[model samples]
Target: MDVIGTSGLTKRFGRVTAVDHVDLRVPAGARFGLLGPNGSGKTTLVRMLLGLVHPTSGSVELLGRAMPRHGAEVLPRVGALVEGPSAWPHLSGPANLRLLDAAGPGGRRRDRRRRVQDALERVGLGGIDRRPVRAYSLGMRQRLGIAAALLRAPELLLLDEPTNGLDPRGIGEVRDLLIALNEAGTTVVLSSHLLTEVEALCTRVGVMDGGQLVLTEDLDVLRAPTGHVLVRTPDPAAVVPLLDGQVVGRSGDALVVRGDDAAALNARLVAAGVAVSELALQRRTLEQVVLGLTGTGSDRVDGGTT
Candidate 1:
């Protein structure tokens, strides 16, 4: 079953349409990534799904229940960490989690302490239980926020830029944790400006542009080779004609051919007396795909619901 589904989902702030008429579905056990540059409406869409923002038009169903109407029933089963972490500076990490957990649903008096400690340990923040939150690093705070989200052992985790402020180590920690969670049957929907992070962690990806979902597909398919072959020969001028119209362009000392049969192309190159030095297929990276889809190199989208 689809853990999250929306139809004709849209949100407009006066003259600005933050989220366009978008239809989205996230199947159970999917490590889905929602990617877009600034103002592409990723955050707005997440908000609508969580019932944090009322959509201007359309319907939403999360965990098979209608949104807003059944949000109280459904949201308890979902965890979210959006717009960075917020905690009481004077309070210790464990204390902050205890407070947040108490306020959240499904925590019983007998299990609150043990649940909070387990969450802290899960996020790698258990060692600093006595330290004030103000002394914790940005990454620690982010992890604490994640622990808070996990306190209820949610089935779906909606994380927006969960690795935003972390160092390389912190980013790796979060990445590994999310991967482990997904492997254990939790569906994760990650929204982030980091395309590389999405590429590494998510099995499926959705690209948004101008507040519209431009593309959505499996990550492997999206990054698959485009059947374009790159050939490097001693004589580029001599090999150009042998490829017929398959020549896409020339890259410095090589010829780019749009063909699937690499062996045939190689044979033709050799038959034509073109000394082939290299024959390689070209593949597009996730970054390249995103750039081509958005037409803008901007990595981040600011303001407006994010």
Candidate 2:
């Protein structure tokens, strides 16, 4: 079943269109990643999905219910941590979660406390509940935010840049936690600037650019070889014509051919008296694929607004 769906999902702010005629679908239990450069309307689209923002046109559905109209019904099953962590600095970790749980729709006080403690344990923050929010490290704060989102045992978790300001170990911790949550049957929709993190954790990926969704596909397909072969020869100029129109371009001293059969290309090169040195299949990385799709040509793996 599709846990999240959108059609012609457009959002406009004043004269600018933040999201434009976009369509999206995320299957139940999927670890889905939404990727884009800054200002590409990723946040706006997410807001619309969560019924936090009104769309200028089109529609949104979450967990099988139409959004805005059924927000109350749908939202109870969803949890979100957008922007970054927020907590009462003077409050202990457990205390802060107690307040949030009290405000949420959870059951009795005892049930709320048990749920909060379970959430803390799930996020690896149980032992440090007594630590003041001001005393916790950035990673601890992020985990606390996650624990708060998990307090109600939500079916769908919407996290935007969940690892924005952490060290390498902290990043790995969060990554593993998300994987465990998805494995435990929680549908996750993650938006982040970290491409490697997305590539590692997401089962499916969607790319947005200029407020439009340019491409969405399975990670396996996105990471597959692009039917291109990188051939290093003594004379690229001599092999160029022999390759017919299969030659894409040259990178450094290698000729890039847009063909599946590297053996055939190498045979032809040899028949043409061109000494072949190296011939290797070229597979596109998630970063490369996204950059090509967005046309940003940026090496930095960060999201931005349009």
Candidate 3:
């Protein structure tokens, strides 16, 4: 089931088209990655999805219901942390979440404490005290924002640059939490410029370029193994002749042999008395695929827009 669907979802600011006539779809229970360079309309598109920004022309559906039209009903089932998490600088993480929960629908006063605690713990901030968010580090604030989004335990999570300002450990914690949530049947729609994060966490991917939805495919399909194998051997001289016409490219002790199966290539090399130190299927990297499809981030001019 598709949790999000959009048709001709265009957003414009005067003469500038921030988001073109783009169509986007995200399936349920998927770790969907929304990738784009800066000024590619990723954030604008996310705002439209949450009904925070109305589109110039287009339609949106969330959980199979028309968005904005049914936002009151649909939004409660969705959790969002956009443009990074925001909180009152004077309030502690728990207090910030408490106020937000109190303001939003579906938060029970009786359960608010437990809910806040759980959200914080999930984000690795359960030990926080009355220290104002202003005293917190950038990484702590980011985690606090995520905790706020998780307070409702919504069926869907829409996070943008979620791990921004996070250390390597914090990043890993967020990734693991998202994976756990997806495993438990909550669909995740992540908007991030971090290509590596998307490559690591997403099952499906959507690429945006110049406000257009340029590509959308399963991660496996986008990164399908090319019909080549990479072999790293100390004896490159000996292995090259065995692969002969099959060798496409090489660098020092590394060889790119044109073949689909690694096992077969390894067998052939071993049979030819070559010491196979390392051999594996060569596939298009996420970076290679993205770089090929997208221009430099600065190339996109959104007319002073983000």
Per-candidate TM-score against the hidden true structure: 0.86, 0.81, 0.96
Across 179-217, the per-residue lDDT of candidate 2 in tens digits comes to 988999999999976799999899999999989999999
> Judged by lDDT, which candidate is best?
3
Model 3: which ten-residue window has the lowest total lDDT?
A: 297-306
Q: Rank the candidates by TM-score, best first.
A: 3, 1, 2
Residue-by-residue lDDT tens digits, candidate 3, 1-306: 899999999999999999999999898899999998888999999999999999999999999999889999998889999997788998888899999999898778999999999999999998998999999999999999899889898999999999999999999999999999999989999999899999999999999999999999999998899998899999998876676689889899999999898998888888888898899887898888888898665744575532
Candidate 1, residues 1-306, lDDT tens digits: the string is 999999999899999998888989999999999998977899889888999999999999999999989988999899998888889999998899889888876679799889988998888877775879899888888998999889899999999999877898888888999999999999999998799899989999999988898898999898788899998877888877776788889967788999877888888878777888999778889989888898453544573331
User: Per-candidate RMSD vs. true structure?
Assistant: 3.9, 4.7, 2.7
Compared with the true structure, all predictions reach lDDT values of 0.88, 0.87, 0.91
Least accurate 10 contiguous residues by lDDT in model 1 = 297-306
Better of 1 and 2 by lDDT: 1
Best by TM-score: 3
Between candidates 2 and 3, name the one with more favorable TM-score.
3
Count of backbone collisions within predicted model 2: 8
